[model samples]
Target: MVKYPNGTFAAFRKSVGEPTFKKNQKSNYYRKNINFSDRGMTLEQMINESNKFYRLKEIAVVHKKPTPIQIVKVDYPKRSRAVIKEAYFRQESTTDYNGVYNGYYLDFEAKETKNKTSFPLKNFHEHQIVHLTECLKQKGICFTIIGFTSLNRYFVTPANVIAKAWWTQNKSSVTLTEIEEWSVEIKSGFQPTLPYLEAVDYFIADRKSKNGKYKI
Candidate 1:
């Protein structure tokens, strides 16, 4: 039986579409019996590990923001047991990671795509852009670490570049060619997993050389 408002099986199929349910199924973050160090972990996991490594070595203090949740219902089935039945996102999150590095307030977001041709704009949230803009105004170092999983390429693109593209571009995505010109690709390393600070250093150096002041 079709549960959609269309009701009829054929109509429901047309509305729901075929293979989309499976195609949209989220992939597992962890794989059983697989060596992630060789297989590669998710961008989030890699970044988390890198942050821990950096902190332990007194390199930086980056951390992920905990998104607030609104609890709707709770059930108490036992004397010491309480289960959350319903919850919702309280509000839009600012960005993924933020911290201090060498007297600079660093703020950034990490994103990944399987598409080889372009990075779609749909992956970004409007509130994130607004937050980045605010950070820029405060002279905070802001950027995005984008990974093209299919191409095995990772880039540290400035937040301003992305913000401008989002506002000026007429298309729904930023082309790979454009990103290559605008971004600095970071080489993957075994020690830090994602040594993104290397790219950040390059960006800061360029900014300092360009106008004699490197605030962002």
Candidate 2:
């Protein structure tokens, strides 16, 4: 129970009725992602919500690419009912998502890791690096959304960074310190959820600045 300035115990909230379990404890949000403040939704769900927010505001259009499916056998028990008994997911040739933001072509892969110290390079595939490198060659914005689930931390890491790491024979994973130094941290929120566009803006602007072509 909480006490007011007068030192009286706080009354129960009538709107919520009586307590069912233990009292609620304040969350330490400074160390955790804001959109994950509730610790309920997955990274994909957060990104999807952020995309919806951007679309509603006419900011930029982005979406996850659906994996191609091959239906081998189908059973129709009724005239109006069809059940897919056999199917296989077709092989993918690209990353998880691709679309346009402002004038830049955005392409990325969303990944999650349970490990706390580092993200394993084994989680990334050679084909993904090749595809992203190709996209970069076309002057497109290519990157990744890496989520450390156990730590509840997230980073916007560039594809080239991952590519470079993969090429190093002895390197097996990327450390948290390396990520903090090289990647842009995403600020999660209630409205946009992931709020990743801000990171994209920063990424593009930083690249342009380094290339001596940064403009307003």
Candidate 3:
């Protein structure tokens, strides 16, 4: 059996272990060519890039919350920049990204899964659910971008739907078939490829109509 350097048995695990793909792998190529691919850029990178595009075009303002770093040690070199010698992953205090678009406070999380069917509930945490619930109560436009690696499909599943499912799944895990049914499938394009805001528009329209507050 293959053993990790940490002396843990590695062969029995069905899914790829940590550092599954090489850091320098051709992620951008896969992002451009593969459907529902989370290849080159991480979900955080994709969202940051999209936000940059949006900001450049005066579309909307969005940004990723910087990952807090607890620097335990640093190496100061005489002729170069100081390198982080040791650090621990700090607990995140907020959602992945947030910003404003057309007067709406937008908040969201970007997640990727290798599962061919349904994304596992384990991917999300209770804190995130609580945060999203608070955002919803305040009328923020909250949602998530789910990447299905094996099937090459990306979807925008609204926070409300996710919260309900997440609560129900406390008793059982959600199924892949269920995600396919509820998610708004995204088709990547050239400019602002994901075009997720359009999905947001639809969601807003549906909610307004349901509440008898529809306009235009």
Candidate 4:
């Protein structure tokens, strides 16, 4: 039972009606309020939602790559319930996602960083870097979807730019200024959340204009 600020049950009774639950019966009340201020989705989650929208609209085919893992230990808490207690990666994964868009093979990694000024190079693994480079060699549209969580900004940076920086740059991170120069900015939207295919299209057009080929 609840009472109004005026110390009267009249308002509560009117709002909820009479309680009809008998003794020993369970009663569940509907929640009237929900807070979503701290419920923002992660970068990968946003990308997954976008991929789902794309598939539903027949706009593109994209999927997150599932990492292979070896389950070493399992615990049966109950007869009908089991839990994986220990697992290990079977092998180093190439990238986060892969798909075909506009007859072009798209392979890329999705990453998020909390840093405001730059993205740390340590976020990427050596094998992943090699994989991106190899994909670029096969004329695949390879790139990275980088999200700056602190700034709520996203960019699609080409793999070549990343490779160049990884090898030549002395700095341990890629600055936001450099990303702004080499990458295409992605805008958040309601339908797909992260509209990154637009950035991919931008790269295709830019590459065609420069070399008469969609190599990036």
Ranking by TM-score: 4, 1, 2, 3
Report model 1's TM-score to 2 decimal places.
Answer: 0.76
Q: In model 1, how large is the Cα lDDT of residue 34?
A: 34
Report lDDT (Cα) of residue 142, candidate 1. Answer: 90
Better of 2 and 4 by lDDT: 4
lDDT string for model 1 (136-191, tens) is 87878899989888876677777877776665546588888877776767656655
Clashing pairs in 3: 27-40, 36-152, 118-176
Judge candidate 4 against the unseen true structure and give its global Cα lDDT, from 0 to 1.
0.72
Candidate 4 clash pair list: none
Evaluate all candidate structures by whole-model CA lDDT and list the values in order: 0.71, 0.71, 0.64, 0.72
Please list the residue runs of candidate 1 whose C-alpha ends up more than 4 Å from where it truly belongs after superposition: 1-40, 74-85, 211-216
Q: Could you tell me which 10 consecutive residues in candidate 4 have the lowest summed lDDT?
A: 21-30
Model 3, range 68-165, lDDT digits (tens) per residue? 66777888885578877777656645578899888888899888888786787777776677778778778888888887766666777767656666
Clashing pairs in 1: none
Colliding residue pairs in candidate 2:
none
> After superposing candidate 3, which stretches have Cα over 4 Å from the reference?
1-39, 76-81, 88-91, 169-172, 211-216
lDDT of 3: 0.64
| Per-residue lDDT of model 4, residues 80-161, tens digit only | 9988887777776789999999899999999889999998888877667778877877888999989888777788777876
